[model samples]
Target: MQQMQVYARVITQLIASEDHTVQDLNSAISAVLRLNNINKSESPQHLKRVAHYSRLIATNCADTYSLSEEWIEHLYLFAPLHDIGKVFLPEKLLTKPGPLSPQEFERMKTHTLKGRDIIDHMIDSFGYKDHLHYTGMLRNIVTHHHETIDGKGYPYGLKGDEIPLEARIVAVADILDAMLTKRVYKEAWSMDKTLKELQKLSGSKLEPEFIGILASHKQELMNIRTASAE
Candidate 1:
């Protein structure tokens, strides 16, 4: 995901106003999400699922991971931005019904890096780069969610626990949502099949512990998905 310089300028203008207030910052983030089609009309509740499952997993594993309540809330708010880079991609590539060409796949992989730059720009526009705890967490998810536990994943190839916890957590939520939802390339998968496929990826493409945590709350996740469908 090379920088989508074209969108950067437009999005910067959209976010260029005062962001000192919490309301202003939230509005800016919403504007960026809208540009990327993460809002309700565009994504058909995909962002809702990601945000719900991210929080669901964190809440279920809070004791194990020692996650503070505030951090859990942040994951809910920020996890959906993982695919913000797709705003830069052409519509044909985003909805192509077949496997991407090697060239296309390469272009697609840059979304994570591009997403990071988007967050960086947002933080810079807010003039609060000095206070980066929240922004840093968002940037980590944007850049690292696709990364795997093994050194095989893209962009930086960060292995094992080296990837940020927030990204690792969102990776599971993102994959789960993709599996349960129909896309141009594939039909929605059954819950049983989705779980088995994810199980195969555990410890290699995903954190085994988080997968287990998600499995333990299978009913809750299904409930969330069901609600999204309605």
Candidate 2:
């Protein structure tokens, strides 16, 4: 218990500080999650890659949309936590080799709210008043990352501008990574196929503007994917 408290303190400090490097903070968070055996099937490197892609998408969207640099930085830092909800999923579901049963799928979907609950609990316990902006944004992003632009997404079926831009950016990054990365139940799709699919989803499943940014920077995004693999 004492050791756990010490570690929690360190994590809280790292997250709250503006000057802490994102790489260091992410490393610490991943370490804790790994120690808890939450990521039994997925490689830690996969999460790192997703983080990279999400940040890239966020940065690109920020530039294209004329968002403040500070806002973009916050989005980049909080984007990884979008899937931190997966930590709440049972290892069996997370590592399952076959497609999930409807019941299992429903259970898996709760990770979004579960992640929000976890962050909310942390804020309540730690009294992280000032970090509210970052934490609040992250919580929303985590809960809504799976949501689509056309109201097909789960949890809340927000459409178009109804979804926050941060969530919209993450939705694109998340889908891209999921499609390109090999998984237990399916083989990886080619980048061309993945981009084509994303294009198909534009205006309906994804924001057209965000998709445009992704389309324009296809090579850079691929480089992030390749570099993270090594």
Candidate 3:
């Protein structure tokens, strides 16, 4: 309990301190997750890649999305936190060897809402008051990222543009990385295969525009993978 209080204080310091840089924020996120026992083998790299992919898509589609530089940077910072609630889930559930049972899947779906609650609790408890500014974007990314474009997603059936732009962007980033990375239940898919899979999901499960934007930056994505690989 005392250690948790210390962690909470560190989070407060990281958020409220003006001297803290992005790297500091990243390190704090990593340390927190490590303490919580996420999949140490792949979680960090997955987070880094999603952050990079999100920033890449946001920067490339800036004019269309009306994304400012500040927004893009914040997306990179918060993208990793999108799955923070996974720490609240069980290890067996997270690393299940195959398809989730119906009950398990329902439980899994709660992570998004749980993530939102965690962020809110942290902000309220620690008084991070718009930490780095635009904290709502973080909440949006954490909560709505799972909502599909076709109104088929969980927690809320938010459809079409009803989903926040930040959430859409994070969703695309997340799906791309998840498809490319090998997990306990699946092998790492080839980049070509991953793109094809994303293409299939473009209109229904994900925003098509961001997927197209991601596809256009294949080379840079490769560089990101190389740099962020576990």
* Each candidate structure's count of clashing pairs: 1, 0, 0
Candidate 3: residue 226 lDDT (0-100): 89
In model 3, what lDDT does residue 182 have? 89
Of the two candidates 1 and 2, the one with more favorable lDDT, higher being better, is 1
- For model 3, residues 1-230, the per-residue Cα lDDT tens digits are 34445544555565566566777887887887886656543487788888999999999889997878877887888888888767677888888889999999999898888777766666777767655476688779889989999999977999999999989999999989988888889999888899999999989899888889878888888899889886
Q: Compose the digit string of candidate 2's lDDT tens values, residues 55-86.
A: 77777666567888777778877776676667
TM-score between candidate 3 and the true structure: 0.92
What's the best-to-worst order under TM-score?
A: 3, 2, 1
The segments of candidate 2 whose C-alpha lies over 4 angstroms from its true place after superposition are 1-11, 131-133
Top-scoring candidate (lDDT) = 3
Number of clashing residue pairs, candidate 2: 0
- TM-scores of all predicted structures: 0.84, 0.88, 0.92
Best TM-score among the predictions, by candidate number: 3
Writing each residue's lDDT as its tens digit, candidate 1 over 1-230 gives: 23455455444444344333434444555666666544432263677688888898888889988999989877876775678777777777777788999999999898888778877776665465675457678789989998898978878999998999999999999998888888777889988888888999998899888788777888988899887783
Return the lDDT, model 1, position 206: 94
lDDT of residue 113 for candidate 3: 81
Tell me how far the alpha carbon of residue 120 in candidate 3 is from the true structure, in angstroms, after superposition: 1.3
Q: How does candidate 2 score on lDDT? A: 0.75
